[model samples]
Target: MTTTPRFKSDAFEAIHSAASGLHRSGVVGKQTMREFDALCLAEAPHFDAKSIAAIRKAAKVSQPVFAKYLNTSTSTVQKWESGAKQPSGIAARLLQVVKKHGLDVLV
Candidate 1:
């Protein structure tokens, strides 16, 4: 059998601490963490405009109400639902969150 290499927890902690220092020195804004999260969601395979719209409809919520819940505009929701437009970047990520968590996020 082939052996896998593993590092100790302290080594990982040290690397993390060094990266945090670089991040705090104007090398990286805390915003990058949020951006990275957005990227991950955007890269997630399951998100699509149709799925987002269907989720809202499935929840039996009106377009305006759903938009308000998502902190977006009614027209935007309509565009997404009708396939007249598509969400990109952070908007896509937010839709992914809404899909998984439901409208309770608004509350």
Candidate 2:
């Protein structure tokens, strides 16, 4: 919470308000709920390759070690660094958490 958020407070507040209205309407289906859960899990900070690499380097971990910490493969880490692929789903969110809250969240 020490870091300033990327979003403006009013923008975030509006988004939350919309979500609250949706919930109040009781129109959220099971499929919608599942999708929402996925969104929550993968709410990435939108880091690019350089940023991703910086984070790993900052953690003082090699690619393989970072992969192990993420329960993924070094190849995936390489792909992220190379921009061959973007980290998605839970992995992206986890990285965001690490960036904001420190790497200890994985532990």
Candidate 3:
């Protein structure tokens, strides 16, 4: 039998809704890079080396182009793909957004 992830999804939505509410109010203010990193870490899907490579390839962008779009270095992107390093924090979030929303986030 197959099971549904209704409860887990509900929890994610609740946390996201609270974050949205804080943003709507003046309490949260604008998201700084650090805060954005934290939020993305909390909310975005985690990417493995294969996933990172797939995302870049799926976007039909070269490593350097993807690096430029992420404001990172081509060496870093290569490291991520080779699993010498992981895309944590901002890079991870950007990768997730790109996976979900496409390369439009670049333009």
Clashes (N, CA, C under 3 Å) per candidate: 0, 0, 0
Pairs in steric clash, model 3:
none
**What is the descending lDDT order?**
3, 2, 1
Give candidate 2's whole-model lDDT: 0.76
For model 1, residues 1-107, the per-residue Cα lDDT tens digits are 66332223555545555655778787867887445334332242345567877888877899999888777899998888777777765577666777778767658
Q: Quantify all predictions' global Cα lDDT against the true fold.
A: 0.68, 0.76, 0.77
If both were scored by lDDT, which would come out higher, candidate 1 or candidate 3?
3
Roughly what TM-score does model 2 have, to 2 decimal places? 0.60
Alpha-carbon TM-score of each model against the true structure = 0.53, 0.60, 0.60
lDDT string for model 3 (1-107, tens) is 66322223556656655665777776666664336435533443577889999999999999999999999999999999998998876688788889989988768
Q: What value does the lDDT take at residue 96 in candidate 3? A: 81
What root-mean-square deviation over C-alphas does model 3 reach?
11.0
lDDT of 2 by residue, 5-105 (tens): 23335656556456646877886665775554454332445779999999999898899999998899999999999998899767987898877776778
